[model samples]
Target: MNTKPSSNRRLLAYALVYKYRIIAAILILCCAVVAELGGPYIIKTIIDGHLSLDEGDMTPVLALLGGYLGLLVLAGAANFSQSYLLQSTSLQIIKNMRMDLMRHVQRIPIRYFDNTPIGQIVSRIANDTEAIRDLFMSFMATFIVSILQLAGIYTALFILDYRLALFCLILPPIFVLIMYVHLKYSKGYITIMRARLSDMNATINESIAVMPIVQAFRREKKTLEEFEVLNEDRYVNQVKQFRVFSLSSRNAVGTIGALVTAMVVWYFGGNALDGAIRFGVFYIFIDYLGRIFNPIIGIFDQLTNAQRAFVAADKVFGIMDMEGVEVEDASSAKRPEGAVKFDNVSFGYKDGENVLKGISFEARKGETVALVGHTGSGKSSIMNLLLGFYEPGEGAITIDGRNVANTSKQELRKHMGIVLQDPFLFAGDIKFNVSLYNERISPEQVKQALRDVGASTFVEQLPGGYDEPVVERGSTLSAGQRQLISFARALAFDPAILILDEATASIDSETEGLIQRALKVVSEGRTTFVIAHRLSTIREADQILVLHRGEIVERGNHDTLMALGGRYYKMYQLQKGERVAV
Candidate 1:
């Protein structure tokens, strides 16, 4: 929401990258303008000379034509140089803009990501930034050229006939007013159109990602209908925008045409004007006048698009304006003693209705704690807080007696590793996905990590071993295989504390056995927190915490909690009964 203004001054900050090249482009443009004016002057000379019918001056007429042709060729070459400079400048700006946006995104807090839509973010990076770049590259030079041409024409007309030049000035003000109304009304519609298009894009993205579920449930028709609704909204907005554009364009050009027609008739009607203005001179004046007004109208039209471009840039800069994750230390902070303590911690998504309340607990320097509860019982919320994904509304969390809020998230997370229910794997080779391009770890270390997680056998069985492409989100690999790769990634870090959030819940019994064994070796002598649906997995935990409605209702080791006959005992009994039935 805190978007920055796309100030001309701000855009000028990029001059450091393309200043010299742009200067060359400007010089080319100047040469082209000189040629443009010079060619028309030569035509005026040829026309006047022929009207006089002076045989002695025929050679001068031929020389004027030759000079005009030469100037035209010069203009063509200058135009090519201008085009080359503009393209190179635009590409360079786009490269730097993307890099800046990416770096800004990296620093934004995780909470911003949770609240923002993936499609909107995609639009900012791909669509919005591109819109800005195109607006710059296409309009900036044309706008400058139009201004120069208009200024030159005005001066030429004044020098030729001051009375007609004054008349021409009157029509531009009226045209400007019409364009102002068009731009003011249609700018808002442009924003709406862009937003609707983004919504449609998001819908398409979601549908494609969930195509399997949609097909399995036979909801294709419903999805199509929804898409139709979105597309209709976009069409209506676009229509409105185009209609305003058309009316404004016609009003500006038609008014100028009528004015030009009246001026020609008025000038010729009087003997004083007809005696002075020649047919050739009049024709040239009309041609130059049309050229002048056409670009003026175009500038007005482009102003509307420019407004839309600014709105998009605002959205992009807004994301960049958000508070970045604070970095506590420049040098990597040394690992703390992995002693976690939650003292009177309470937190909620909004401001009220706490999801974690007055919870007090500790996982010693080298211990395993399992949080078990039914859905919406704050198990995941606690884990989220531990990872600093969200801050507590009341009280504090400490690692080795230092409050988490005081330390940088980057520093805090260096000593911690998390293996979620679904581990993310980028599209790359197996080795690259695991190492994530961190050069500190070697290929041999990657192999050892995979072997430690029991993933080496299947990985080697693949066609290219470590070189095999994982595909998007590692879909080429099975769920169990993906989990093993995640485990390998976590183990390779050699973290002091590991957070396992429903890690083995989705796997089969055989795969779970393999994972559980690997987890034992990896988790030993390290503080670990496990959230599990299966009661059997935490039977050997140093302590077990049972949550109920944001409060810890029961706490003990596996046997003690079962002996106490509380929430944990009830959950254990339910699982045991289900196992017996199976």
Candidate 2:
């Protein structure tokens, strides 16, 4: 998606559901304008009738006083309602936008995540959304109110005196021209400020996320220095923003002050001096004239805010508009059978550079296929493709002759289970993580899954057992414990196909033995694919494929490959030198 400034149409789409509230706001504005205009008219009535005449008109004067008081009260009530309706609508729109963005992010391909900066994605969801809130609350509603007030004031002024109304109208265009130029110049600078702010936020987020690693290396002082540089850049950008803002404010005030002065001298003075308009009438017009320009100035100031909001909205919408992973597949497509095939698969992130090239493989029902490769030799890519995280760029992958591309990802993945290098657990009880919305799985079944994975041993030792609280990303647990919990969770699902991508690499040999026993139960009667860095982990596999670069360089049973003494043999010898006892 092109990340350019979004137009008004996308913004309007957010407002459609709130149309009634917006219309209500407009009606309230109408009442407010009527009340505001009535105040001056009452003053004119009292001046032209009560003060000019004797005590005979005193009762009518009191009634006019009551009318003026009533109008002011009405204006207050209308303003209050308008504020509530507009603010309510804006907040709801923001809430819906956040939800949509989050859902869209979930549906997008994993490759998008691999290439995009996490900070930028974070900025779009958090900072940019906040900017949009500011625009809607501060600029959009205020701008609308200003326009209505200006229209009402000018109409009232015209009814009172056409020449004075014309004079008021003349100044707006000149001010608008000046405002247009000022906004044009400020737009680039504001864009720069916004980018700097996002960059700063991104840096801070990354630093805080890696705090454990930084502390482990004792790089606190170095990290602080790096943050200080980012902070300084943010400070410089903020200072520049303030300078531009001050200049714009001064220019607006100066221009409006000059116009108001001119209006008072040229129109109000002439009428008052010639007795064509009374003292009260002229003074009231002067008051309304000043009030009218308040909205105009407000409108001008909001232009800057509007530009910032547009850019922020554009970034947010850009993410939403991204081509997410294709989820559309006919319901008629059958659930894939227990067989996996990669037919001349070729894949890559970018043009002309294949990470997995012309690779063909198969895993028959109840077979264990092990993949051994160096880092970045497309082992994980194969796992990703198998799990439907990405689609092959060339050739097809299928399950029992049902092509993956012709199937819904959700449908395809229902039969699959995967344990990653690092497993993630949410902030909840251990039972909740294990259940994962599968209420059909009873506590007894959950216990069995945990027992099968040998996680029940430590889990039962915890204070609350399955009821124990897991903190954010399971930071409260050790790496081995997290993997054990993940294994239990995967087993609870009872998928037809199982994948282990370096699942035991982080655990010690002692835990690995427990996991090996657990895996024996988990892999029974299921198709299993294992990506192993440690050659010993896949020693019992029915078949092994040694990948070099992007192709399968060798494939055979473990004993057969070891006897041949190829790349796999060389890797095994290197592990032996490292004293990895197997």
Candidate 3:
């Protein structure tokens, strides 16, 4: 009847993957507890059995002392072995969990990224996962050892004298009640703490990314004020959580443990003075009572970490549960020959709000189709649909008569490429950026593609030439150089369809002229779709569709649209500085 996993179930499942190692660690922990517990009883033997005897032979006492020393050594060895095993196993489990998160992020819908912050995603993978590492390494390991120690000590106490042990039993219930109170209070504080921490990370990532703009606009004080608010909120919650933790864990254990110890000693010691019980039994009672509170304290101490791990794992599982496009090894449909058609397609990023309404258009094989529209005219949305980044809500899209919705997204994108206005380049050399580490694209292809896109003029002049290392986002290169590299990256694939999404808008006119020449060569045998802001750039396009709002108002070549004296003509005249006010 219950469909959701238990609170600790996700953590346990990951640990179960390395059950053999964890079992070995737990077994070693038990050995350590037994060795450690035996020491107090051995001292009881020394005190009441040998040393208390009048005709004492120091020989047996020395032997008992030697035996106690050996137990101490054994406990030490077992403790080390168990710690090592658990730490290694914890690292391994965390590794697998992080890998799962990473792989899942790759498959999750791009819409999720569009909505989520980059730094918050990074926190989930980096910070939240590190906190989970503590669950296995410290919390669970401490919990298991503490439970075994408490069980062993209690069993020893009962054997010594059940009457005295009964008083110690009271500590467990009171400790449980304390933890219940602590959990009731601490969970809320910790939740706020985690959320604030994630928000801080997001803010920091954003601030660093836009530091240049912030300084240019003199917004440093405002940025710092914003970050300080999140930081202070996290600090407040953490202090509150720590207060709850302190009240429940060590302090509560100490107070209740002292009261229980006093009760057992008053009753049992009075009985001993009256000769009602042996001093040996009394000594053993004192010994085992000393051992009881540690495990209880340990349990309470780890509850904080347990709650955090639960929250973080829930966040992680939430991401994994979302629907994603399943990748296939091969596409069922044959490779398209670049005949892209949008048939009455309607789509929106949000529900009940269409961004592209009833958009019907086609670009036949090897023909150039340009989408001309003002800002927010839904040009990029069309490209997103064609590339299968999104699907139309109300209509069908087909490439070479193969329904794109039915094709695997990976396969559908395999033979298509795009160059954006602000091109993104990874931290790699010119060759690697072009090839994108695809083995099918050889070093020769990387060079040829760069040369074809006219990127070689600047690239060859650099000290490292094609092997020149690129920093993050290619900030080391000029704007035109980066754009040229993006164009070459598209050409390196030799795609059946190429999209230029305002690709030349950000670069200088001299570089634009070079790309225009290169475009003539590359567009010879591919279906080229250009989403352009500069009307002059699309003048030679085979066909142009001018869009207003979410619908096409004019569709024709540049000259035909000029003769129509419509929106496209007015936009073109405005660009050329000819007084043609619509």
Best by TM-score: 3
The list of candidate 1 runs beyond 4 A from truth reads 1-24, 50-58, 250-255, 258-262, 269-274, 278-280, 326-331, 578-582
TM-score of 2: 0.93
Candidate 3 Cα misplacement greater than 4 A, ranges: 50-59, 331-334
Local distance difference test values of all predictions, in order: 0.82, 0.83, 0.88
Backbone clashes under 3 angstroms, per model: 1, 0, 0
Ranking by lDDT: 3, 2, 1
Give per-model TM-scores.
Answer: 0.92, 0.93, 0.95
lDDT of 3 at 133: 88
Candidate 1 has an lDDT of: 0.82
The window of 10 residues in a row where model 1 has the poorest summed lDDT is 2-11
User: TM-score order of candidates, best first?
Assistant: 3, 2, 1
Q: Quick one: best lDDT, which candidate?
A: 3
